[model samples]
Target: MDKKGYNTKGRGGGNVNEGGDGDKWSRWWWGLSHRKSAPSEESSNSNQVQRSPSQSKSPKQKIRISSRSDKLPFYYQNWFLVLLTLMSLSCFAFALFVFLYLYPDSIESSPSSTSPASSEVVEITYGTVLKLMHEKTKFRLHSHEVPYGSGSGQQSVTGFPDVEDSNSYWIIRPQPGTSAKQGDPIKSGTIIKLQHMRTRRWLHSHWFSSPISGNQEVSCFGGDSESDTGDLWRLLIEGSGNIWRKDQRIRLQHADTGVYLHSHNKKYSRIAGGQQEVCGVQDKRAENIWLAAEGVYLPVNGSE
Candidate 1:
């Protein structure tokens, strides 16, 4: 009975020892699994931290690209506005230049035919500015500062073809020792003096032979204060009107020489080319007829 009990106890003790060893092996396996799991979790956390920064920077880069694209339209729009402004200014300047070039008469204030003061028929009075036109030759009596090459050697006179020449303008004046005033009416047989408007000279004639016709030399001589009997001219009215009218045909007879102002088809060559010669003739021919043309005539008794 005792041997049987000992065997039973020994078997029981062996069973307890096997149970302790199994417990220790199970604990070791559990610890090894826990350490491996810890390493895997740490690697996963590190990977998440690195990916989070890239993800955060991606949105900022997208925002930067979107901002650049949004500004492009505004930049082009600003340049377009500048170009439009420059084009508009250039067009305005061109238009202003064209306007000034087309209308030059708006600034000119000379005595033209379209002037307001020369639109009506007015009487020829003393101090009246006028142009004398030859009836037969259709030339204007003109004079300049040029001296005659031959004959009287005074201020040369000619018949100008152009009606717009300012040199043809003459101011009618009374004789130096006459009672006639500025606005007085001129009679048919009145003795008058023609004063050049430009040079202030007087129409004069002398006994010297003419250069072309060899009859007499008619020229412009003297000034506002210097005058002689050679500057005098007698008006011979052809029609019946006692008062000299603008439409009346008349003849001028020199007071010094018994000659009339004449012009022919003969033109000058060198000094006054293409201009008709103005001279004096003893005969009262048809070439000596003259009529008053474009002028600033004074009103008769202020009734223009």
Candidate 2:
């Protein structure tokens, strides 16, 4: 039962009398600030302040500190809401973790199944070329897929190789367009009949190889360089047709291939259209103005 009292053992003590003229708060203020003509704390205060690098707070102090936020009503401070929110988030995280652990694959992904997949087909056609570059390169030919109409009264024929005398070469077979490979065994009724006149060109760098219809240009004696054939050579040949689609180009990958012609007896020229024809040493000797094409009026004898 030690109540707060004054100490007067030294001259450094305060002059607080037992019967002071004030209440507790005033007394405390007087004790801290008021004094006779004594020196200030700057000159005489000698109590050393003991501090540890780290302090272990007492249980009472800890309880007092923790009670500050806890004792307040929900409207008094924001910390209660913050703590509640953190606790709710922790609980939700724990629930999510447990759910994922129990059913890993069942968790709905951020990109739901309703989202579009990467495997959708996108159609792209530019200028004269209607190219469809896709992961799946091959397309199965169907009679409906063939670009033919109920009219044109056209029929399919064989012996394209026999006419060319080179099975290694045939023409770019129409519809179900394919790369340089064996022709697929299409249905018998399937044939390519066009209402518009079909045309193609053979692309050669050195000389006029041939074209599906028009005359071909050659590097004069047809060398790989333009110097071998000058620009002064359009009048030497003939050019017909007002509109020849540049997209309608042919690749003379080899000499063995020949184009399929329909029932038309008119003579037509052909040439390489795509790549600049590059010639090597042996190509110089082959004057056989790279046969572009041989026209036909009948399918049976169309090979040139």
Candidate 3:
């Protein structure tokens, strides 16, 4: 047992020594062993430091992965652009529909939309002076001056303005209202009769043959002062003259007969002198075109 204890003490490098020289050798050996163990511990710490970064980097990589997943998908990324494009298209469609629906009539009535030959027509009013002219010879419509005492007399249209005949001016009186008092508005579709401003006679035509033009019927000024079918005439605006622009032509059609008021190249006798006798014909001619303008104001009565 004593020898075993001696060996254990010797392992400490002369731990059995009791003198100064022995203690010195023991301390030196112990110092050498401690120094060798310290280097190994330092190597282990350096390894731990290097492994720490790799261990912590796993969570950091996970954080980066999660952050990337949090972003919206590529398909949904441009949601704002998609919504804006849809809204813009919808607004444009709505505006286009509104424009087309609101102005349909305007588009149809536009001059560019209508046929080249067709034109817009308008209305003609009362108190219009119509100058009946020959298609070949332009002449003013005239009536014969009544004798000193005559109820009604023969009438003819003349182009000669040599004498300013008041008979040339005829007042359009709508038969619906009072002869000279309550007058109705004269329009393209209105049924009217003309009265001689001076003779105070309404233009009347019968089945009688014209003395001058044996082929056509004669038109004379004679009818009831109130109203008569023979006196009623239908007024129409020529081709495109219904718009009532200045110098528009008018047409007079006999109500009793389908003939139009026409003057020929023939010369006829009249109270005013030699004038063109107005006749009624079935065919339309250039002479049938008549100009209308505001004429003398003939009062319905003394107070009117």
Please tell me which predicted candidate would have the highest lDDT against the true structure: 1
**TM-scores for all predictions:** 0.62, 0.15, 0.47
> Please, what are the lDDT tens digits per residue for candidate 2 over residues 1-304?
1256546333545455455435656878777666642445534443222222124346657888898869997656787888889999999999999988997755343222312233532111111112111111111100111111222212211112112121112122223242212222212223221111122211112222222222232211111221211211110001332221121211121221222211111222222112121221222122112221222111111222
Ranking by TM-score: 1, 3, 2
Instruction: Put down candidate 1 lDDT per residue, 139-195, tens digits, no spaces.
Output: 989999999998768999999998778899999999877788888888988999999
Q: Put down candidate 3 lDDT per residue, 1-304, tens digits, no spaces.
A: 2655535355546455468557778899899999999999998998899989999999999999998877868548788988899999999999989999998776665433322222423223355443343445655676655331222224543454432345666666666554433323344645777776666677776565555665455444654445467788887776663333324567778888877777766775445355665667788877676764324322222333
Q: Which 10-residue span in candidate 3 carries the lowest summed lDDT? A: 114-123
Quality of model 3 by C-alpha lDDT: 0.60
| Deviation (Å) of 280 in candidate 1 | 1.2
Pairwise TM-score winner, candidates 1 and 3? 1
List the global CA lDDT of all models: 0.85, 0.27, 0.60
After superposing all C-alphas onto the true structure, candidate 2 shows an RMSD in angstroms of 23.6
User: What is the Cα-based lDDT of residue 235 in candidate 2?
Assistant: 8
Ranking by lDDT: 1, 3, 2
